[model samples]
Target chain A: MTESQFPQCRVVPLRMLKPETSERYLNEVVKVEGIRRMMVNGPSIPAVVPYGPARGSPNPNSNRRTIKVGDATMELRVQVGSITFEVEDAGVIEEIRKVTNAFFTQFPAQVLEGKFMKTEASLVDYCRYGPNADPSVIGLVDPRRKEAPVIIQGRK
Target chain B: MAYTPQYGPGTSIVAENRRKQMNPNYKLEKVRDVTDEDVVLILGHRAPGSAYPTAHPPLAEQQEPDCPIRKIVKPTEGAKAGDRVRYIQFADSMFNAPSQPYQRTYMEMYRFRGIDPGTLSGRQIVECRERDLEQYAKMLIETEVFDPALVSCRGATVHGHSLRLAEDGMMFDMLQRCVLKDGVVKYVKDQIGEPLDREVSVGKPMDDAWVKAHSTIFHSLAGVAFRDDKEYVEYIQRIHALRTKYGFMPKEE
Candidate 1:
């Protein structure tokens, strides 16, 4: 297992602390943020996701609308012996940063140094244009489109 | 073929002849005691080896009984006919008595050697004794008093045994002696090396000093916002403060 296989999130070193404690602290911070899910690199899984009640319905249902947080379908990939994250949701990128920052801030004296690096394409690509597509809803158009513009969101 | 005459149908001829030759004066008697001379003659006639006279010395003359064996013997006192009597030897009462201190002393010796006294086999205990000289010296040092005779014999009584000034002193002596003899200490040592004398004030956080020491690190890190939102900034700060105040640093990396 290469280090790059798991998405390397910027983490502050807390002196002499068990890895489990840091993981737990990070988890708690992410949970409180209403951002229910995120992902860490290995196994290419999503840590969290929001499942709407109208998921199967043509119209959105209010009752089943719930946000699932944390790694769900994140996979760790090794490229050139370096661990890389295959993130399912790009939105979780911000949450990972927040959790990492929060963890370091809790023990600033222990943070020797840290760095943030973004790499690898996301597994999930959101389509911006569809049958009922609103121009405002469309973000990025697919670069490969030759005819009509196909807007898509690439996860981080 | 020529016919030969058969014997008489009635055996009167043979019977009549045997009766004519018979002498009816033969007699038999049971012998109560046979002398050496009689035995020699009997052997000389029956077998060649028997002719070589008996080599055994004459039996010792029996002494006249003070009371007749029949009169003195109580037939019902012992086992019944065909029964066997078995003798079982036990340790001397002085050694085996419940009140005897030897068992306790021996057990203590075993404990020092790291052997459980109750479970020690005889051979193990004997082995322990061979290795126990150093234990004896240690015991003497801790005890502050010595009596070789106390350990030498089972029946020797201890006189005027007094309690030592310090209980620890006594226990230490016992432990030392046991280790010296047995090569192991069985009991747990309870004493902490240093005395805890500082007065712990009520309502004060116990680890306040450690928290204060790491406050700079906590404040700086806690101030950073991973989420652009305002709520997470406050939450991270609170977590930082709480951990700094009360949580112990993890022991391992």
Candidate 2:
């Protein structure tokens, strides 16, 4: 099949950290160092857009934040690769800190340490049928640290 | 120079002189007398009310009606008389002539039997010829017209039994049970409709997660959204633990 036949999905590079480092230490370092560097060097991230109606019942006590863009609703959940930070309203920055902390905690003494090289984020739209909502997404975001190509030529 | 008659004298004398020159001893042997039985005659036998007698009939033709079996043996018929009769009857059916109604059916049958009309031989050739003649006979029979006996030539052997009849029977069964049944079209329509409705409503829940994950550069660059949920976090943790323990890394594409 030709390339045109396939629907393009995001592909990104990831760097996993050693397990010796502490999550607390990694999270502190990432919030101070990593986020600052990305904000300074990289382009600004796009705004969050809402997708659709909430299908399931929202948690009563937990702050259920939903952002609306057009016909979509956005929900926030905190994930850190392997470790999750149960932060209230843990937006994109907090989510990044959690992932960076997990990475460093997982891998400690590597040159490309304490952070993932890249990641692919997809915007899923889900439908609610009673308490059970199906998980489906539309747009995708793929971010990666640029890598230099290594060239090797045959000696004639 | 002037031409002159080579022989000069009476005409009979000149003729005798030419004969003598042609044959020196023209009448040497004396004539012999003929007996009654020795009187050989040309066109001798006379038939009644005819000028000349015809040649006598052959020995077989002259033989008596109840001639001994050994003396006048009959030709053994290769195929049974009944079979020939049936073939004749079949030929006289409505299947006579190159009609479009049976063309497809016959061609399919021929193909199934690996019979090529262009290069028919052995029994296949014979069967095709027989079938054609039978079709013609059928037409004649339908029109109530009698035809002369058809000459049977040696044809190629058509292997296997009457599979055409069996296939026809199967087709008939299919037409009755499946094609002609009610609600078949509706059932097919329903199968197509359900999938379309289900597809439109897909993808609502995952939209929320995407928005939450990529809200800022920190989350997007750090790749934290990959493990945004509890299940994903657990899965990643298991992978990390396994990798740390085994010194194995996730396979890179």
Candidate 3:
């Protein structure tokens, strides 16, 4: 694929410190009618308490709850680390920035510009989901795990 | 004989910052005043005003082994009180945060005693007597070594050190333990990401300029790279050469 066909997303990484803040940010950003697809990337919210004395217990992080993104109701698998917006064009980047700045202005949130995700499928994508899988989903695939991960909508 | 002690070998600002922290004589500047109660809440070890849970009977109650080493080394207050060993972990952002795991370990080893410190890629955990941990934790939290946005109070889900910082200059926490409010970063949950009863304000993160200026980590992205520091690179080369060459035999001759 040519460089233009490569990841064209003008990434406005809205990195929030807290999951609730991130969840709120996600809810607001998705509502802004700007351009193309938007996805948040961050460290995964583990299914179990990964370590310490409470290891193996169900991770009941409140911020790991499902959030409304436009019309779609999606469970946030990871604490929304940073939100990447794939605008239809560069025009909406400024609009999204205005909405984000109003919210993140009090705190230390930044507006970083770049191509955050891969537009093309990788070896892992082929190994896990196959060739016909959506390009958007390719970037979302967990690079580490090939096996199916249980996606729980509600915290157990 | 009085001999000058060297902090790590480096010529960069990162190296200078390391020396400032490692030297006990150099007082760490206060960054914020997170109340003692707020600190306890964030730690999630015990409740405010609660008695410290003990692991064993007080030192006074235990029979002394006639070892002279015991007499020479005075027991810490927490040990005397039989306080449980508790730990506080910090994950410093790699994007030029004031301190990182190795630097943190080096500083703690020099300044504190009767402690056990564990260093990982992004996080550093120090285990000490409960009361002592609290004291050390306070110093660590209040001092320049910590920036609420850059250094996370993470015990379990400490995955965001190397990750790109969020818009607000806060480290990425999957658990979302802390929130950046009006101007302060508050702990909505404990270090391990357990929900707290009340919000514990850790204080606002340092501005970008301050965080960058005080950071000890050498990263090409934000701060000076290790390759650029000729003396540091030479020191590393010298150490590696000596270890490989003389490891087979103590003396080259």
Assess each model's interface with DockQ, reporting 2 decimals per model.
Answer: 0.01, 0.01, 0.27
Full ranking by DockQ = 3, 2, 1
Q: Can you write out model 3's per-residue Cα lDDT over A88-154, one digit (the tens) per residue? A: 5565677777777777755545656677766677687788867666554457565444444222222
Model 1, B141-230: lDDT tens digits are 122111111111111111111211111111111111111113222111101111112211111111323222212111223222134434
TM-score of each: 0.16, 0.13, 0.74
DockQ: the better of candidates 2 and 3: 3
- Kindly report which residue stretches of model 2 are placed more than 4 angstroms away from their true locations once superposed: A1-27, A30-54, A60-76, A82-156, B1-253
In order, the Cα lDDT scores of the candidates are 0.25, 0.23, 0.77
Candidate 1, which segments miss by more than 4 Å at Cα? A1-7, A18-20, A29-91, A103-105, A109-156, B1-253
Q: After superposition, how far is residue B167 of candidate 3 from its true place, in Å?
A: 1.7
How high is the TM-score of chain A in model 2?
0.19
Q: Residue A50 lDDT in model 1?
A: 19
Which residue runs of candidate 3 sit more than 4 Å off their true CA positions? A1-40, A46-75, A79-156, B247-253
Among these predicted structures, which one has the highest lDDT? Answer: 3
lDDT of 3 at B46: 98
